[model samples]
Target: MPTAYRLLLPLGLALLSACAHQPGSLAVHQQSQCPLSLRSGQQVILTLPSNPTTGFRWVLRDGASSLLDSLGPEVYSNPEDAGLIGSAGQSTWRFQARQAGAGHLLLTYQRPWETEVAPAKTFDCPLRVQ
Candidate 1:
């Protein structure tokens, strides 16, 4: 069915986007539209794009503290990690309305075996949930 194909398209694309890379050097050449906004009490899906197999992690942060961590769409085995980018070299994280405040997406990429955390970027995704 057309609807089923449409739904499966994203998943197929995600799998095709995965690429193995050296750890600690996972870098995003660029970032597209990020930090999507959603209404309070409403649920929405936000997709974070990344380079294939970059080991991207999606971290939801509420101010100074973290709310949750997720493993996105093309994460493979090998190195043990909590979060992995799904197929399509991107991960989709869900969001819900919370306390009418601001939240942030903290994306980090560091080399293997080192905690230096190089080439890290933070995106301000604001939602005035009311």
Candidate 2:
């Protein structure tokens, strides 16, 4: 094979792989770890630590984006020994990039019944779809 062809082939494959999701996926907890850009059809997951036993849950304050679509309903999971009682776990939200445009996601941690109280935590992720 030509040297140029070999070089280009690997580079192209790398770029394509970058657009695909990694195996055994998990949500990103830290906002700093969030990707600034993503390719169309790529999915982004945001995970936050939560303890629903206390009545506080992560809610989607603003996740509507023309460039993105919610993949499915939010999911929650608990660690091993789920029967241990009062154990904290995680909540996740997934979104798939639909087209080339800007995207926005906002999440707030609060109790749904407490309207007068402020959220305990918040996550905001802004993204660009390519």
Candidate 3:
């Protein structure tokens, strides 16, 4: 191989590595008609398996009310589902709510290296008393 090609090879490799797919995304479920369950308390309970990624952050909004905030590491290999991240970024609004009432909910997620925010999803629904 040419000496020039050898000298430039490592630089080329570095450039290629920099272009690797960034970590982070928001997904939602289509045709999902499941309801969100809310209980009378300050905590929301739900179950999910770990997603495959670096980390995740979540935000919960009640459309008409101030945001109910919760943030945590998004360990994709473990049970990492942000109740506020929504299913595939799709949300049922009333699921895992800490209050019983009528309200709209939106879930969003983002990671450290993400260039764009996950879809700003909004779900209008009634919080069913569980």
Q: Best candidate per TM-score, number?
A: 2
User: What are the TM-scores, per candidate, against the unseen true structure?
Assistant: 0.41, 0.74, 0.30
Q: Tell me the whole-model lDDT of each prediction, alpha carbons only.
A: 0.44, 0.80, 0.39
Better model by lDDT, 2 or 3?
2
Candidate 3 residues 53-129, lDDT tens each? Answer: 42544434343243222333222222247454333322122222334455544444445356475533333333343
List model 1 lDDT by residue over 19-69, tens digit each. Answer: 332112122223444344444345444555544355455444443122322
Candidates 1 and 2, the one with greater lDDT:
2
lDDT, model 2, position 123: 82
Decoy 2 TM-score against native: 0.74
Q: Rank the candidates by TM-score, best first.
A: 2, 1, 3
Q: How far is candidate 2 from the true structure (C-alpha RMSD, Å)?
A: 7.3
- Per-residue lDDT for 1-130 in model 2, tens only? 9999999999999989976655333357888876557777777787788899999998897775788788888898998877768899888888877799876678889999998999998888877887
Question: lDDT-based ranking, best first?
Answer: 2, 1, 3
* Cα-based lDDT at residue 12, candidate 1: 83
Assess candidate 3 and give its lDDT: 0.39
Candidate 1, superposed: residue stretches over 4 Å from native: 1-37, 51-88, 111-113
The ten-residue window of minimal lDDT in model 3 covers 88-97
